[model samples]
Target: MAKKKSPPETLLLLPKWPSSAPIVDTHTHLASTFEAYRTRYKDHATVFDMVRAFYHNTTVEALVDVWCEAPVRTVWREFADSALTPEDRTLKWGGIDYWFVMGVHPHEAQHYTDDIENDIIAAMSHPRCVGWGEMGLDYHYDNSPRDIQRSVFRRQLVHAVKLGKPLTIHTREADDDTELILKDLVPKDHKIHIHCFTDSPEFAQRLLDYFPNLYIGITGVITYATNTDTSTVIKNMIPSSLRILLETDAPFMVPANLYNSIPELKGKRLPISHSAMIPWTADFVAGLTEGKWDAERVMIEARENAKRVYGI
Candidate 1:
């Protein structure tokens, strides 16, 4: 049996707001994750609309929302294509405005070949596609052959290098392969992020050494301490100059506190976590990184690192 649900309480917020802090979300499948959230929440018009409405009448700082998504599914493509309007393309960050890493996820790699890569190349020319990825390997599930994943990943790396854009990687269990292939394929000037990092700090150090430009994306894993308990190790071991960014990896990797009573949350448990839940994850990082800094500082610095990486 499940525990009874209670209304969420708004906790006291942090102080020491940084004026120039980017507050930029390094990675988020805003439309992909938010729309699913709105649909399931039944009352919310997707997480984006709810957030937009909430901030509508309020004066706020700049926010960079990424267009990450699993465009492989026909349903995903149709829904996202229809939801994005001319104005929805950029969420108005600074006077210029922008979006984050936009690309076909590795799970959808098999559906494309050179021709499809060409088509995606054309689409990637979209003004908002500043970062290329969510396109690394995943050994946990051999959903697509390793060969196909590498081919498409290499194609995008080439495209990103040509476009002078940054790269965002998504690696699962295939970390060594990811590092090797990227070292061989990725360009020297490109910015990169190994999103949802939870490996040992040694692995984190190795990643930095191999890909000096790569940023470690700290997700909600810091809150769920067991097998995913590598955040502290990463914090202690990795250098700050490498630049660490925070991401929700929402619609998955929901933080522990939100569902602690569920029991199963002691390990991996994904039902339908929302992209808007980034705050909970961000707060978790603050606590894990020795709690030396306030929440605002963490958000600000992480955002600044993302902006530097994405050129936002």
Candidate 2:
């Protein structure tokens, strides 16, 4: 019998972005990323420690970390408070500007309650809190009943719209309902982000046509072999007219290209993704553009779009 070969050693290398342009990861889960790192290394590491290790040499200027839990993590206060000033951010987060968005995810829609909403509402007043969301429909899992998802989604939308905050949405396998609710509740000119979009190009076009300020959040998922929708959307849309934002959705979609770029990585996968990985996602997006754009252009455009949508 042939001996089973051992798997290639897993490696995590920082992206070689090839440019000095600063990038902002418009959507990520920082605390979740920290937790993933802690789990992988089995060390009692601080978020600051993770930041220093992963982001020291990268051109990651800022990140919009997400907080979409039901009861709202208490540590959110620590994260938000730390980003209140430049001095504080420099000291705690390695000078990476930290902004956050708060909401209850569609998966947690069943756990939505009045008190929980109050906490999210109060977070909107925090200077470091840039938006409200990641709240939308997720029929793919249907972790919560569809009706409950819709109710909680709309309730959160009402609060976010009333507060005049930007939106970071999460929609999957429920494009029709997501579209209906968004069109019905959200203003046409509202700053909206369809985070980690993997829906069809037609749906993307419709949303783009309706919402002038809405930008599609692209992640490392675009580099996957199994995904064509994301690349199709990039190809069909004119690069000059691209309304897209680069995000990692970190601790989730580590760009598949990372594995291919480094010889030592072989078939191993990174345990977590972070803001510094935006350039890899940008590089993949550039490939989809058929030479019309490059990694640096993608980074610059995404940074501009992040400012337009989140004002960060």
Q: Highest lDDT among the candidates is held by which one?
A: 2
The lDDT values for all models are 0.59, 0.88
Clashes found in each candidate (C-alpha, N, C closer than 3 A):
2, 0
Off by over 4 Å in 1: 1-22, 45-48, 54-98, 237-242, 258-276
True-structure lDDT of candidate 1: 0.59
The candidate that wins on TM-score is 2
Over 173-209, each residue of candidate 2 has an lDDT whose tens digit, in order, gives 9999999999999999999999999988899989999
Clashing pairs in 1: 24-303, 38-46
TM-score, structure 2 vs. true? 0.95
**Would you list the clashing residue pairs of candidate 2?**
none
